[model samples]
Target chain A: MKTIFTRRFPASVKIIAIVVLSLLLVLSSDSLAPARQYLSTFFSPLQVIASAPLEALDNVSETVKSRETLMAENQKLRQLELSISDRLLKLEHLEQENSRLRAMLGSPVVTTQRKLIARIQSVDTDPFRLQVVLNKGIKDDVFIGQPVVDEHGVVGQVVEVNEFSSRVLLIADNSHAIPLRNQRNDVRLIGLGRGDVHQMELQYVTKNTDVKIGDMLVTSGLGDRFPEGYPVASVTGIENRGNEIYSTIRIRPIAQLDRIRYVLLLWPELATSDASAPEVLSQ
Target chain B: MRRSPFFTFLIIWLSILCAALLQILPLPPLVDEYFRPQWMLLTAMYWALALPNRFGIGSAWIAGLILDVLWGTTLGFNGVMFGLCAAFMVENNHKLRTYSVWHQSLILLGLVLVYQMLFGTLSSWLDDALVTNSYYASSFITLLAWPWIFFTLRKVRRRLFLS
Candidate 1:
């Protein structure tokens, strides 16, 4: 057997053998996961270098912005801040009252997990898949399956993590589906990506289901991958047809997925998780 | 003067690196879908054809592996595709060398079409992707990129051998 193995085949034949073996290895199991992680770490610098030209262009565009627009933005923000602080006062009071009620009822208080802000470096907007490379990873305690969100709502979960960067499989990928509950009716359904930037469709809803256009959908925390009560998408259209068993419901993602720049990484599993870094940015 | 093989290999990898950069370079929202060429594949194919004895299927397989990581696919998905193309180029090197660059590009158009269909079907089956007819736009765009990449690589290889 050793003598037969040592006998060399032609180069093409050898390459064919190796390629088929490696492809099978990858397809059958995740034994190469560690190797892929290290390779991705080694490749991260190249990824950053590839994205530099776009970054430079963005910088140039940022510098030439008008002062008038900045001032107008600042003026609008001051009013928003004022209104938010007023709401915060009421929220603080309500939180105290709710906690007291919870204590009396012998319930556990909700714990706030530390979060870190990650900047998106590059995006893979393929017809088959949707993904983005974030400029944060294992060193920053970003674990696989970590929930990611933008300022407005849930963006995606961390799918691949390297030493210095990780890849996020966005909710808009055709292969991706998220558990969600309608905010108004509270009916639970799964949202499936239609491989488009702006649309996701609901699954397993009957024709008689109560759904209306403009109804908001939030993550139900059913799978525990996404935190509870964060906005995911809002219903854009709904169609009921007798031929189909399920009504066609479309929802537009709340986060501006097309122009996403920054996202927040959440620490969902607090104590048992290896994400114990203390210097994280609070969400 | 005997040129160091290491330097030539470096030059080859650098060229492929530039191709990888072009692969990820973002464009305008409207044009991006139609314009991204298979830069890495084209560069590897040029070398596999021009220097089959040296580049061979091995380098192309490695290039595909890197692309798999870069494109975030399962490890050997692109490695298989690229390996197949590089092996084909090596086998057809003599017949291909008789043609002009434009003629070679016409051949590339056919290869790109087949590659695209196979890729689409495989991805849809494995990754559950819902693909449409519009993905074909990039194949023609890939054909358009071939001449520029071929000439540039040819010039570089000549410069390396001369010194």
Candidate 2:
């Protein structure tokens, strides 16, 4: 057999060529985003097929849930629903009064946002990134930057939308950051994910900031990606070093990132026009 | 003994598809994070070692491209790594085949380490983030898995084609 390294072009030359090619590809990755999105259209079906067995296993477990446990869960859910209905009655009265006050002040009436339920198709296994693929996509009117939440609080934002599947960048991803404020004191801060599923870090807050352990952090709506007043995380730890410029504040995300089975996709009031902006910018 | 070209091609493609499927199998998050083997790389190395002329750098590059798309990474990231690994395997195929399985496993451990390091560096550079140590765990897992993978592929190749 002929050897790969001939006298003319040795192994070193081939290796250099591969290195240069790789660097060029990396540098041009942004330009290749469109290609990647197009390719994802093809991958969507494969993803569905790959996750089929897991989905089947989940169904089997659901079917095997004991009747006694189901009855207990049902009782608990009914009691919770009754309490929530009571709160809803009070909220309805308060909302009507607030609308009347707004009309008296001649302000525009608030519009109700639309929401869609999306099932989690699969979770990305990359340790460095925390992302999940949702079953809803462009066909379901899911758009990039759409806020996703669960029963508890904010889950993440839709980053990539394909035809049948969309990728959500979780709040636990290292690259994710959300502008949030302390629910108690209204002290605004940026919560950044620490590349872990359980924790996020509060950045740019000074040691003297009025943040305390167990304080709830909610989206401040400053970035326009997530809606205002949605729970994001709760302060879990605060370390104030003597010589440090800022305090190290750690938070536990409210949404169970690992256990997410379904998410609600919020359709922003200005979604129609704003949805196209990300595609254009990405190109 | 000479094998039919079509049969050989079929086996190669089938093995690569199986590897890709294994790579994407849904496992528990913690186990997936720390223990997922580099299936495509191992299959590429197997092909390069067992049948260098038929499945060399070009085949490895193609397999890597498929893995890149599957893993949703930068297009050429895995492609370049797999190409380099296949190049090394092809260049040293004779010596690698002559060695015992124990020595082969040790050599593969080194190769897997280099592959992990290169991949970690490239991804970190692209994302402008620090490389996490968990990335190295995959290489260790792949090293432990190499002997089994090599033996299985060898058995398959021999069974499929009487060479």
- TM-score of chain B, per candidate? 0.94, 0.93
> Which 10-residue window in model 1 chain A sums to the lowest lDDT?
A269-278
The DockQ of each candidate is: 0.45, 0.44
Which candidate tops DockQ? 1
lDDT of each: 0.80, 0.79
lDDT of 1 by residue, A71-163 (tens): 998999999999998997897677567656766777534323677999889644344678888999899888989889998888988888999
| Docking level for model 2 | acceptable
lDDT of 1 by residue, B1-163 (tens): 5467677678888888888877877677557677877888899999888777557677888898888888888777677778888878877888998899889998987887777787787788887877778788778886678899888888988877722
Which portions of model 2 miss their true places by more than 4 Å? A1-17, A92-112, A270-283, B1-7
Q: Largest TM-score belongs to which candidate?
A: 1
DockQ of 1: 0.45
Candidate 1 backbone collisions, by pair: none
After superposing candidate 1, which stretches have Cα over 4 Å from the reference? A1-8, A96-112, A123-127, A269-283
Docking class of 1: acceptable
The first chain of model 1 has a TM-score of 0.84
Q: Please state what fraction of the native interface contacts candidate 1 reproduces.
A: 0.47
